[model samples]
Target chain A: MAEFSLIETIRERCAVARDDVRLGIGDDGAVLAVPIGHELVVSTDTLVAGVHFPLQTAPFDIGWKALAVNLSDLAAMGANPAWATLALTLPSADAPWVEKFADGFAALAREHQLALVGGDTTRGPLSITITVFGFVPAGAAVTRAGAKAGDWICVTGTLGDAAAGLACVLACEDGADELIGRLNRPAPRIAAGLLLREVASAAIDISDGLLADLGHICARSGVGAEVCVDDLPMSEAFGEYADAPTRQRLQLAGGDDYELCFSVQPDRAPALLWDLAQSGCAATRIGQIVVGREIMLTDDSGAQIEMPLRGWEHFA
Target chain B: MAEFSLIETIRERCAVARDDVRLGIGDDGAVLAVPIGHELVVSTDTLVAGVHFPLQTAPFDIGWKALAVNLSDLAAMGANPAWATLALTLPSADAPWVEKFADGFAALAREHQLALVGGDTTRGPLSITITVFGFVPAGAAVTRAGAKAGDWICVTGTLGDAAAGLACVLACEDGADELIGRLNRPAPRIAAGLLLREVASAAIDISDGLLADLGHICARSGVGAEVCVDDLPMSEAFGEYADAPTRQRLQLAGGDDYELCFSVQPDRAPALLWDLAQSGCAATRIGQIVVGREIMLTDDSGAQIEMPLRGWEHFA
Candidate 1:
C-alpha cells in the first residue's frame, strides 16, 4: 500500500468526527461550521522529547498530556472543545507505539467530545503538538481582562499534584509512579469551567504555577490578588512522596497544574459556590481580587507570607 | 530574558489582530468569528530534524517552509488564509536562532496577512509544527472528490525545483542555491487557487509529488488521469542542478512543489485559462481526467511512458 493508504488506515481508526464536522480526513483540509451564536476557540501546544518528558515516558501518556494541556487552555477560556488537529513527529513508523498513543488520545478525546479533524505525521525525533478548537457564545466567553476588585478568587479541584509528581520523578523517590501518573495525565477542568462561565469574570489555567498564572490575570485585569497560603488544596497522595515543606514548595512553585483559576464577583460568589457544591465540584475560595498591583500570600493567622518569584521559566 | 519572554517579545512585536479575530495572544485560547456563509478550513504539518531538512539548514528557511506548506493546503481547498498557530520545539534557548526564525516567520505572515493567534514553545530536538486556518464560503471550496471524467487537469507554476534543490544539497553541489531556495521556500499557489475557486472542480496541493498527490484526487473522485509527460512543468532551474535522468526523476517523484493540481470541466476550461492569464498566473493543462482506474502518462507523440513512484513516504 502507498503512504496515503497508511494514512487512511490511521485516520479511519483515529478520533471519530462528529456530525457537526462538515468535513474530515482525506481532503486538502478539514472544514467545520461553528453553530450559530457560538465563537470558535483555538489553542496549540507542542511537547518535545527530553525537555517536556523523559524519554522513558509512555507514548500513551505523552499523547494524553498533549491533548489535555490544550483542553485546559480551552477550559480556562470557558469554551467547550469541539475539534483538534495533531502534528506528530516520530523516529520511525512504530506500530505498537502508534496503537498505544492512539488509545490514550482517543480516550481523552472521547471523554471531552473533541473530534479529531486533520493532522500530519513525519519522521523526526519524538514530538507531539496538538491544536485544539472549542466553541462559546459571543461576548460570553471568560477572558483575562474581566476581573475586578472585590471579586472572589476560586480554584477548581486541587493544585500541585502534577508538580509533586514531577518532583518524585526528579528525586527518584519510591512509589513515585502515582505522582508521575498525575504529571503525565492532567485532568482539564472542562465541566467546572463551562459551569462557571457565566459567573466568573475572568479565568486562567494553572500551568505556570499558581502565583505566576494568577499574576497574569491580575496584570491583565489591572487588579491585585491575595491568595491565602493556608487555603491551597493538595492531595493526601502528595504527602506519601513529599515532606510538608517540600509539598508546600512544590505546590507554590512547581508547574503543570491544569485546574481552572477563576474570579467571581463578590455578589455572585454565594450562588456560584452553591452551584459548585451542587455539582460536587471541589471549588475553594483561595483569596480575593484586591485593588492594588501586587500579589500577596497570607498565612493561617492572616499574617503576610514571603516567597520567591520562581516558576517554570522556559529559558532558564 | 527567558525563552517564554522571548516568545512574548515576538508576539508583542508582531501583534496582528483583525475584527474576525475574536481573541488573540495572552488569552488561554483564541476565539474566531467566521464570517457568515463561510466554512472554516484547517490543516497541520510537522517538520523534524534530519528528516525534512538538513541539520545545517538555516532556521529562517525552516520557519518559512513550515507555514508555507500549510498555506498550500488552504490554497488547494480554495480558501482564504486567516489564522495560524505554531508549535516549535528546540534543543536549547538559542537567542540568535530564535530571532531569525521569528523574523522569517513574521515577514511571511505579514505578506500573507495571516494572524499568529497562538502557539507554544518547548524544549526538544528541533522541530516545527504549524496548524493553519482559513475560510471558504459554504458549498464553494474545492475538494479532492470533485474531479470528473473528461475534466481537464491543470497545474500552477513549476514542479521539481524544490526536489532538485534537495538533490543538490545532498550531493554538495554548488551554484544550486536558487533550487535550494525553492526547496526551502516553496510558494503555495494561494493566488491561483483563489482565482480558480469558482472554476476548478477538484484540487490538491502537490506536496508528495505530482503523481502521488494527483493519484489521491483520482482515487477520491473515482476518475483516472492521463498526464502528458511532455507537459509536466519542470523548472529550467531544476536542470541547472541535476542531470537528465535526475531531472526526470525529480519531476516525476520528488516532492515539495506546493503547487495546486486542480481539475476544470471541459466547457469551463477556456474561461478559467483566460482568467488565469489575466491574473498573470502560470498555469497549464497537463492532463485529462479519464474513465479508467490508472494514472497513465503519455509522451508528445501519445505513447505511454512508465515512471517510478518516488514521492516522500512515511512507511516506505
Candidate 2:
C-alpha cells in the first residue's frame, strides 16, 4: 500500500532513536516509557490549508507550523517535548510535497529530540493534525489558573511579525523576508518555559495575539489585565511595513504569534526577565494583572484605548 | 470567544473526571499522570468526511467511530484507555451537530472510562483527529512481532459486516440495519485484548480486513500464515446478504472490522478462547502461523483460494 510506503518514508526521515520509545512507527500504537516522578503533557492542533495557512503556502511551512503550534502548547505548560503523532490528510499522493513536508517536520523534531512516534496519513483535502507529548515534573505544570491580581504579565519575543508576514503574503508584496520567516517558523519557547516554571505564576502560548491570549490567562485566573499599548515589542521588519495604528492593531489582535504570555510576581519579574534573556529568549513586561474582570488597553497617558476585535474566533 | 464556548459545550458533554488528569480542557495542554510501573500506549487516527464514512452518515455515528477506531488500536496493544485529545475541524460551528457528536463520543468514552482531556476546534473541511493515551504494564504490550511459526491465528467476532453495511448504504437497500449498525459502531475489543495479553503471542486490530491485518502480524513476526476459508466467521446478517463467494471476498478483503486478529500458542488457545467468551467476546480459530513470507488461503479440501485484492489502501 502507498500508505505504508509513505509512512516508511516518514519513518526513515524521522527515525530519532530514543531510549524511552519502546515501540515506534509500524505498530498498533507507540509504547513510551514516561520517567517516574514526571507528568505527561499532551496537546493536539490542526492546520487546514487555505484556512490555517494561505492556499499557496509551501508544504514545508505547513508541516513545520502544524507541529510548531502543538509544541508551543507543551512549551506553555513548561514541558520538555518527547514524542508526537501526525495525522496528515492530503488531497493526493504528491511525493515531492510529502518529502519536503517530512523534512521540515523532521528538522524541528530533531532540534528538540522529539520523536515522530506514530502517525496516520490519509486521502482528503490538505490538513495536518499534530499531537505532541511532553513531560514535566509531577505537580509542577504551569497552568493558566495560577496568576494573582498583582502579578506582572510578560511576553517572550516581539509580536506582530507573523501578522505582518501574513499581510505581505496576502498583498503579494516582496522583500519582507524576515517577517515572512517569522510567520513560517514561529519558535516554540520550550527552554524559557522550563525556566518560567520555577518562577512564573501562570503561562499561555500567545497564538491568538497578545491581547486575546492574555485575556485567556486573566479569565482562567479570575483577574483582569491592564496592557500599556506602547510597551508592545515589535520587530524592525514589522515597524517598516505597518504604520503606528496598523502596528498596534496587528500586535494586539494578530493570530499565529507562537510566543509565551505569562504572569509573574512583581518582585521576581526583573530577575526572571534577565534569566530569560540570558537563555536567548528575551521578554518584556507589557501589563499588570488587576482586580477586575475586563481587559483594559491603556495608552501612554493612562487613557483607555478601544479595540475593535479581541482575537480570531473560528466560527465568528 | 465562540470557540471557547463551543469547547465548553463539548467539555460539559464528554466530561469523565479521572484522577490522572491534573488539567483537562480549557488549557493550552493537558497534564496527565501515568500510573506507576506502566508504559503509555499512544495511537492517533483521523476520519475525513466522505472518505472515512458516507457523507450522509449521522454526526453521532461519525463521532463514535472516530474515537472507536483509535480505541481499537489501544485494544490491539493490550492497553487500558485513559485519556484522549480531539482535534475537530468543521465547516461551521453548528451547535446542534456539535452537541450530538459530543454525545456519541462521550457514550463510548464513558463505557471505557476514557476522558477527553484537551482539543482544538478549527474551521475547515470536516474531519476529526483523535489521539488516545492508554497504559500497559512494562514489557507486556501485545505487539505484532511475537507470533511464532506454530501459533494459532484467531479472530474476535464476525468479519465483513461493516463492508456489507457500507454496501447496503451505497445501494440504498433496506432491512440491513444490523449490518449498517456494525459499520457505524464497531465495539473495540478492549477486554478481550487484556485477556489476550496473557496468552496471545501477537495481535493486531482488523481495520484493514482479516487477511491484510493478519498479514501485518506475519510481516512483523517474520512468519507466514495459512487460513482455512471455510472457517472464517460471519454473522447471520452477512450470510443473508452475501452469497458464498461474496461472503468469502468481503470477509477476506473488506475493511473497518475493528476486531482483533491474534496468534496464540496452540496449547493455550482453548483456555484463552474460553476466557474471552466468558468476557462476552467470542473467538474463532481460522488459521495458523507458518514459517515463510507469503499468506495463503485454503479451502476445506486444502485447495488454494486466490484473493483478487489484499485490502483497502489509502490513495491506492
Candidate 3:
C-alpha cells in the first residue's frame, strides 16, 4: 500500500470525533481550540524499540504503553488530557500490524478523552513518539519544586508492581500472569492526581523508581526525606517473588511503577488519603521532608537501614 | 553517557527565553503555556536518513530542514511558531556532530523566535522527529476545506527551486551550490501564511507536490481545479535546468516545494497578491477552482497538457 493509503486507513481507524479536531491527519498540521480559563499542558515522550521496550513485546502493548506513559506525564501535572500527536517510524508499513497498533492506541486515547489531533507516519526502525496536551487551570498544576521541608510525602497505589512484574516476566515465573500484566499495562493515577491538585505541594509520577524520583523532589525543594520502610505499600502479588528484602528493594528502587508520589502539608495528608480511597486510589504516607540533603530509610525504631540506592537508568 | 546526562546537556544547549515555558527538559515531561486569545496549531514531522534527505547532506542542513518543515505546517495554518519539542534518534552520541546539529537548530529556532521547549534523545539509526506548536487567533485558522469554486489559486514565492536543487544534487551538477542550498534550507513562508489567512479561502503547504497537495484541498472541499501551465511560477534557477516541458513536469509534480498554495476569491486575489508582495512575499496566481472533480492543466494555446500526475508517495 502507498503512504497516503496507510495514512487514510489510520485516519479512519483512529477516528473518535473529528469535530473537536479542526484538522486531523490529512493536513499539514492540526488546529485545536483551548477553551477559556484553561491553560494547555504540553508534554512529549519517545519510546524506541529495544531501549524503551523489549523487542518481542506485542505491538498492541507497545502502542498502549506509548500513549499511556505520556498520559502519565500529563496526569503528574494534574492536567486533563485533551490532544495528542503521534510521530511513528517503522521498518515498513505492515498493514495488519499498524491496524492492531492503531486500535490499541486509539482505544486508550478515547478512554482518556483525548483527540488524535495529528501525526506523521514514516519509515525507520520502530519508534513511537507522542506529544500529549492537557488542560489545567492557570497556576493550579503541580510541580516538583513546591515541596516544603515540613510536608508529608505520600504515594498513591502500589509502589513496585511494575518492577516486580518485570522480574516475573524475565524469570518466566509460573503463577505470575497478573504481575506481568502490571508491567505491560501499568495504570496512571489520573483521578488521584486530579484530586491532589489542590493539596499537593510537590508531585511526580514514579517512572524512575520511588527513591530516585523522590530525590528529584528533594533536590528541587532543597530538603531531605526520611521514608519509613514499614509504611511502604507493596502488592500482594509481589510477595510471590523473592523474599522480604527483595520486595523492599523493588519497592524502594525498582522503576516503571507509574504511580503518583507526592508531598502535601501535614494537615492535608490524612484527608487526602480518604479522598484518594474514594477515587479508587490507595494512599500511603511514605515519609516526611526534613531540613537536610540526604534521603534515608528508617525502620520501626527509626534506625537507618543500609541498602544499595539503585534506580533504573536509561543508558547505564 | 547516560540518558539523564544527555538530557541535561540538551536542557542547557536548547535554552531560549523561559517566560512562557513553565517547565523545560529533565522532568517526566515539560510544561508550557500557550498565550491567551490564540488557538494552538500542532504538527509533527519525522525525517529519516536516506528517506527525507540525501544520505550525505550536511548535519546543519538536516537540522534546519527538520524544524523548518514543521514550521511550514504552522505557517500554512496562519499561525505563529512558538514552541518545539525534538526527539532525536542517533546511532550514537557523536559529540562534534551533536554540537553542530544543535547550533544549526538553535540558529533557525532563534531566527524564527521559536523556543526549544523540550525534547528527547535516543539511540537508533539517525532520525529526527520534531513536534511543533504555534498560536493563532481562536477560530481563525486556514484549513483545506474552506476553498470555494471560482476562487483563484495563488502560491507564495517560487515552486520548483527545491526540486531543481534535488536534481542538481542527484546529477552532481557543478556550481549549483545555490540550488543545493534551496533544497537544504528552504524558507517556510511563515510570514506570508499569516498575511494570507484572512484572505485565503483555503490553503495548504506545497510539500507533496502542487498537484497532490492541491488535490487534498480539493477532495476535502469537494471541488476541482484548473491550473494554467503558462502561469506556473518557476525560479530563474529552475529555468536553467531541463527544457520547459521537463521543467514544468518536474516543477509541477515534484515534492518538497514547501511553498504555500492557497485559494482566494477572484475579486480579492489581486489585492491579496499586492499585499503579499508588499510584505516581501512574491506570490503568483497559478490556477482557479472549477466545478468538476478533476485537476486539469491548460497550456498557453488553450490546449490541454497531457502529463502524468506523479508525486511523492512513501511506501509505494
* Cα RMSD to the true fold for all candidates: 1.9, 1.0, 2.1
Better candidate by TM-score, 1 or 3: 1
| 1 versus 2: better DockQ goes to | 2
Return the lDDT, model 3, position B63: 82
Q: What's the best-to-worst order under lDDT? A: 2, 1, 3
Q: What C-alpha lDDT does candidate 1 achieve relative to the native structure?
A: 0.84
Q: State which candidate, 1 or 3, has the greater lDDT.
A: 1
Give the chain B TM-score achieved by candidate 2: 0.99
DockQ of each: 0.73, 0.80, 0.66
**After TM-score superposition, what is the CA distance of residue A183 in candidate 3 from its true location, in Å?**
1.5
lDDT of 3 at A246: 84
- Highest lDDT, which number? 2
Q: List per-prediction Cα lDDT, in the order shown.
A: 0.84, 0.92, 0.83
* Better structure of 1 and 3 per DockQ: 1
Q: Which pairs clash in the backbone of model 2?
A: none
Over B289-309, each residue of candidate 1 has an lDDT whose tens digit, in order, gives 999779998888999988767
Better of 2 and 3 by DockQ: 2
- Model 3 ranges with Cα > 4 A deviation: A18-20, B170-173
Docking quality band of candidate 2, CAPRI definitions: high
